[model samples]
Target chain A: MSSSTTPALPMHEVRAEATWLQRNKMIVTPLLFLLPGMLFFAVYVIFPIFQSFGISLYRWDGLGEATYIGLANYEELLTDRNFEISLVNNLKWLVLYLLAIPLGLFIALFLNQTVMGIRLYKSLFFFPFVLSQVVVGLVFSWFYLPREGLLNTIITGLGFDSLNILGDPTLATYGIIAAGLWPQTAYCMILYLTGLNAVDPEQVEAGRLDGAKGWKMLWYVILPQLKPATFIAFVVTIIGALRSFDLISVMTNGGPFGSTRVLSFYMFERALSEFGFRMGYGSAIAVVLFLIMLVFIGYFLWQMWRDEREARRG
Target chain B: MFPTPIEKRSRAAQITYQSLLPLALILWLLPLIAVMVFSIRPFSDFTQGNYWGVPSSFELFTNYGMVFFESDMPRYLLNSVFITVPTVIGAVALSCMTGFALGIYRFRGNLLIFFMFIAGNFVPFQILMVPVRDLTVDMGLYDTKLGLILFHVAFQTGFCTLFMRNFIRALPYELIEAARVEGVAEWRIFWFVVLPLMRPAIAALSVLIFTFIWNDYFWAIVLTQGPDAQPVTAGITSFNSQFVAQYHLMSAGSIVAAIPPVAIFFLMQRHFIAGLTLGAVK
Candidate 1:
């Protein structure tokens, strides 16, 4: 109002001179800004989800006439041995992958000191998380190679039998999960390291004065401060566990009797691999994964919403 | 501080802690160290069954040279650059607008839209795979780098928006309000006032998104094929098949494939960690 040139102009003329867009710039501007992003997101991310649900109801190859299957793909999943293995493997991934959080907290506690060269050590220990999962998988596969591998060399040197980890069905999933855990532990470590940086000195001093130390101090004082980090670590770890396709694709290719196949890898195989493009079946598998993810997604969103509310109230 | 600083400990304990740091680091990075050692060794050592021994010959240059000069590794790397750069720019650009709108405004459905981006980001990629592939093919974009970039930009927008909006929100709102009171256009405020302050966030998101798009393997395979358009992550598979059982060359190829993002992380460590640990503390 102060910037208006004709401060003495009639109020009716001033109001008439303002265009609709000018009058509603607050609403118009945000809507205009949101347009392109919303369009792309809806087209590529949001709509695809509902489309997958719809696609799961019909049998359609990539280049063929569609046949409405109406949950038949899901019916097959009920009896499909591969699907069973994939689901169970997914569960194993969810459970085992979570070990990264506590393990990460441990490493963070160890590295939280103010030693010289600690920065380099911290980055080096966090190195694995920066490398691509594909590279990690390749490195581990070579490490686990049967005859000339380093792992076997060490085992034999220690007078223990050399084990072909990826070649055995029972061990393959665990082997791949171990590989997955390397980067994941590094990721969680970084989160906790950041969390530990912000821990209040006064609280630590108080805890010390109260005779808290080691595990007791950590459980009572440090862990509470690390809750935000733990929450994020949990979210990322669970998502990483479900999104276990790249490592499996690179290392095992769902091999060793398909024991390492998770829902993600199985969905890809069903949808596009040479085994036959069963798009509907793949869609069905994807829907199941999405539903599982939705549970966690809902929880994360609810937490964020609660935080947002608290921020508003405070 | 929680672990008790080494300075406060006894001298022997201090020495032990310092010595144990390196030992623990070596153990933590053993697998990667093994690969680095593998990459530098000559093929003669592998043939002589001298694996894990001191390299009979250091062939670092020779092996990486073959990857660059004699294979499709160069093409794949270039493709990776093309794919990653555009996706980073596109996602960051779009999210900046979305984040600005969501951050600055008090419009209806703002939180709803914000939650949508968050939820979409957390959905498994497989749920979006088939339809996105179909949509790409429908637009005659499959088997093209553009197809991959378009989809990556869209999907990553979810996460980017989440990061960006939160970053924008943390900025002082008074600047925007002051700009508005001064009769500055909304778009001008976004461009001048908000965007200037968003440099650190932009830098962080760019580095984070660069690593993500560069390391993307599943989409590379799903969207493109062969050396023509496939990024290094997908092309590494073929690179491996071409040099099967040639451990030295394969290791070199893998190292080459992994270098760019690792390099970026080291170069921009501050921003990278800031982007990653955005909400971990606060």
Candidate 2:
């Protein structure tokens, strides 16, 4: 109103004279825009995290809960053989899953060439990553079927005895990990392939001039430039390792007497599975997994924070 | 370029590289190829112990028809479509606003909020399982597609926000500034200026989220049940349980379930990879 009468009024004065909501548009607009997403996120993702933590302190079934068991769930974890096995298996997953990055890098290096049908090869190599993990798990399970399965068929053709990959307790976790790695390695390979495209050809040529060929050239010249890709690969690989559920869910269901159980699957089996709805025990297990993820999450955030600072400086 | 590019190598080396390429690809896709082969094989082949032999007769249509017409696969596929399309729209719509707010505005707690989305995304789903299910049940939405859709929309927002924020942040700030100087409304600045610039990001994210939500299995089992609400992944798993020995039919079902994502990936191959590796190269 004041701006209409006073035509010479500056923009700021007009903005100030506007409605209160208009005057505070910057703060109000962002909050207005953020409201719906934040509400849903808080309700579904954020709050449940704490809710799960609180439920961990008690021993309540999902329905009609009224029992405060005060750390009994966590205490039980210390002696729980199942939890112990799951943790060990998860550790194995984390360690073995790292192989994907290097394996992926190797394939990427092998295929990064100007050749016929290279693009087709790249897409085909990425085929596994596109399929549902359910399908991958099923396919691998079929592959590992005793005598009739493809893997065993090949093994028997070579005069080796058949192995029930998903049936053997000792080897079941490894089988599932191998299946998981198929798609994971494809994912990392794509990342590295994209990273390879961004590498400075000039630096690589200079390194070759300095007699850095073969692995030496890759290590000294190329690898440094691929740090971003390597970091992402590790992040994704590690996260995938911890969250190894679908394959286990589809292929084995933590079976052969739960030898292949990882924390994520174990959490589900305890809390939501047909056996029982031990919500508190499962939440406790989930809390443990959350803390484990927090270590990597911290490192990721710290690295990103440092990168942000550098970006700001530049 | 990092490798020796094979052309400069000796003839023997080049020949070996060329031959080995197909061999490696075949080995890598052996499982998928096996599944495809099984999909076309007649069930009589499996009954007669011809699992590894050549198909007695190609029954591609018969197998796929059974999966589509005889089984509950069609309903499950429809459930997936219903759940996924809405989720893609909801998550993308939510993130566009949140991404604009966080990406364009310099505000207190901006990093905190954005990182919350990132951290929430990385946290395992196990933590949210019990309560979210309970919450859905309490709301009388358990076993409903809407319940699953709502949960997915919320859960995926964590990821979609991180994606959109980075995308919108990379857009030229001058466009937004110029709009503001022209006295355009703030929402109009978003609707007309930044939103138009976000087309590629939207396409990429839509394809990515479509794949993610379509491929989801955990929450499908957690929140929904039966052919009424369960997606193809969970449904297919249940189907596997029912017909544990029917590899041919199972393979056909898997092929049916795999078509949408595989088609999307091939059609939008560039966008799919771009979305997957968005943060990696940078």
Candidate 3:
């Protein structure tokens, strides 16, 4: 995504000013520009990453003196049933959360036309993505409210029954995820819709000429072109799954006996909430989550690096 | 274009598409629509088992007024504004310079620094929770709006820098080159030549950050507590616990909390989408 094709600072211009400032321009200038953002980024982002890992190796409450407890936090995480549950729930989230991509693509394909009021439809469809997940969680909570909730009302009206979805340990995570997928699918749809708009018309026509249409055309001709959108969708979906904090916090509070707890919420419960301020344990969970995220981040950066290099070569 | 235009299809197909469009949209937005309608109805309706009926009387003004006056919603909303507006300005301001530095220059660590910002933007917030909270407490920033604002600005710079550097990179380098040739100071070149051309990027980022910061709920919980400095997102969660079964008031409060971002999305839809779908289309 590097922007400039033509680099500035042509050779002749470098010698125009013999002053010390101009002589040292390249080194001094960029640093001067970068200082403020780097200062903040280092203190809040970079430094804390290492510090979090350091804290993970200690046995300390948030209050007092720290004691080194090497690997205890991580070792405990191995046997902790709640940690196991949260880890398993996270895996479930990653798998079920992937449904957003195809669901979004289906909606994108459904709505990717020049019909009347299509723009309104597009914006409305994407409206949920704009609202806070807190609101989404609340709305769904109300929608799933035991007997009088919409889900139960409809079920009871049909001579059936409904369960307290948010209160059921087995069903809770899936219930929260259903609420989550509503906005996530909308997000993915918008990405694919944009990708679809930019697909090559000539290639589509060429595919038609070769007797390609429908699923054949989409698979062979169009899906390849939508690779960028798919990659972004995958990246966001996976990250969103990992960062599944706000929804769980709002909907269940890792409730129904902590069945819905992802690493994020569980870490918060251990470190910050009323459970106890076990900073070491919280940071240990965080470090594990960070390692998981690093794998994805490293992959994404490598892909971008290769592409940037390939761009110059091509 | 991929599936072939539905316009050229049969009349029945066109009618089906048109009808299904709204139906699908309504079905998709059912939970939200239910909440929106519930927000304006009187509390009597919820108590009387009128969950999905037309309101006996519209309490739009009453509900919203209560949210503003009878509750801490106003304070929470104000806290959101105080925290969000400054973070947007600070982050965008800093990123403009960082983006300029990394985007235009071919320094020793240009790609390294750029990659750092890109990678840092994706780190889990929980990873920063313990140490960041400790840092804020050490600075006397715990449970304060300024603390939240500073933290948000710093954290957001990673993303804003990514947005801005790419934005600046797309601008013509010739403009900067010409300014340099005229013996203009480097900072002057950035301010006069580059900054004016970056208005669209600034607009895109300003709106994008506005929505991102406004909709942030996790940090609001991790950093601040109570109505004193808690933003509306976290405040609403507190409201949920206090006002159990009071769905009308909760619904009203939710709408109030959601208004700013929704309004921004409508007003600056173009820039918001442009910023969000930056690389999606290739």
Q: How far does residue B150 in candidate 3 sit from its true spot (Å)?
A: 0.7
True contacts kept of each: 0.82, 0.77, 0.77
lDDT of 1: 0.92
Residue A28 displacement (Å), model 1:
0.8
Clashing pairs in 2: none
What does the interface RMSD come to for each candidate? Answer: 3.7, 3.9, 2.8
Model 1 agreement with the true structure over A1-314: per-residue lDDT tens digits: 22322222223444557866666677788899999999999999988999999999998997888899798999999999999999999999999999999999999999999988899999998989989999999999999998877888889999999899999999999999999999999999999999999999999999999999998999999999999999999999999999899999999999988888999999999999987999999999999999999999999999999999999889
Error of 2 at A223 (Å): 0.6
Q: Which ranges of candidate 2 are over 4 A from the true structure?
A: A1-16
What docking grade applies to model 3? medium
Residue runs of model 1 more than 4 Å from their true location after superposition? A1-17
- Please provide, for model 2 over A1-314, each residue's C-alpha lDDT reduced to its tens digit, 9 standing for 90 to 100: 22322222136554436776666677778889999999999999999999999999988887785599898999999999999999999999999999999999999998899899999999999988888999899899988999668899899999989999899999999999999999999999999999999988899889888999998998988999999999999999999999999999888989999899999999999998787989999999999999999999999988988887787688
Model 3 preserves the real interface contacts to a fraction of 0.77
Chain B of candidate 2 achieves a TM-score of: 0.97
